[model samples]
Target: MEERIIIAGFGGQGVMAMGQLLTYSGMVEEKNVSWLPSYGPEMRGGTANCNVTISSDPVGSPVVVEATTAIVLNKPSLDKFETSVVTGGNLLINTSLIDRKSNRDDLNVYYIPANEIAIELGNVRIANMVMLGAYIEITKAISVDSVYKAFEKVFGESKAHLLPINKQALEKGAEAVKSLVNA
Candidate 1:
């Protein structure tokens, strides 16, 4: 299976980190993965986005012209990438920040209140992880266990204290998706 994903938001929103973790998950699973990131010149608060391709076969390039999944954390990103999602693909929106819905009806769109959930979880920074959790649950591009392994290694000894909270954030995201379906 192959998944072309776009994770986008303003800089400092952990957009690149999410892409990296996904790439790490692919690595752990022995899949072919490529990540390409772009951000505005000013860095923080500027536009930031990344394309991540995870596949069972070889990846010819790192570029993503059309994505199978698009995770948009802001309204601007929603506007920019919504149409870029392939037909019959998935679109995951951080509804806490995006007040509007997508224009495409062909895509499976999920509105996740990631920012609100993260705020409630006591760390707003994990909002990205919340979205990641939901995306992983939806696409199964990588398992939560793989993500945990990636997180544990990435956070390592220096930031070990963050592991629990991040784990909570991931599960919270998965639960949020379930709640959405049940609602």
Candidate 2:
């Protein structure tokens, strides 16, 4: 299987981190993967995006012109990347910050109130994690166990203390996706 994904939002929203986690997870599962990140000059609040490709075969390129999936965390990202999704691709949107919707009918769209869910979970900074969890559930491209291992690898010993909350965010995101799918 080959899946190209783009995750985008403002910097400090964990867009790159999310990409890192997915890449790590794919590595743990022994999948060929690539991650490339881009950000504007303003740093924290600047626009940030990353392209991630996971494949069962060797990956040839890291640049993603048309993605198989898009996890858009803001309205601007939606505006920029919505059209970049290939036909019949997946689009996971963070609805808490975005009031708009994708008008395309060819794609499978999923929406999550990531920010609000993170806030409800007592950590507003984990909005990206929430979105990640939802994407995992919807796509089943990577296993939850692999994601846990990814967390262990990416966050390492220094940030080990944050694992519980991060796992919670992932579970919350998966649950959110399950609800949407069931509906």
Residue-level lDDT of model 2, residues 1-183, one tens digit each, is 999999999878999999999999999999999999884465557679999999999988899988999999999899999999999999999999999878899999998999999999899999999998998888889998898888868878898889899899999999988976777
lDDT string for model 1 (1-183, tens) is: 889999999877899998999899889999999999984475457679999999999997788878999999999899999999999999999999899978999998999999999999998999999999898888888998898888767656787778888889999888878765456
Model 1 misplaced regions, further than 4 Å: 39-44, 179-183
Strongest candidate by lDDT: 2
lDDT at 25, model 1: 87
Poorest 10 consecutive residues by lDDT, candidate 1: 38-47
| Residue runs of model 2 more than 4 Å from their true location after superposition | 39-44
Q: Estimate each model's TM-score.
A: 0.94, 0.95
Clashes of 1: 0
Model 1 scores a C-alpha lDDT of 0.89
The alpha-carbon deviation from the true structure for residue 84 of candidate 1, after best TM-score superposition, in angstroms, is 0.7
Model 2 — TM-score against the truth? 0.95
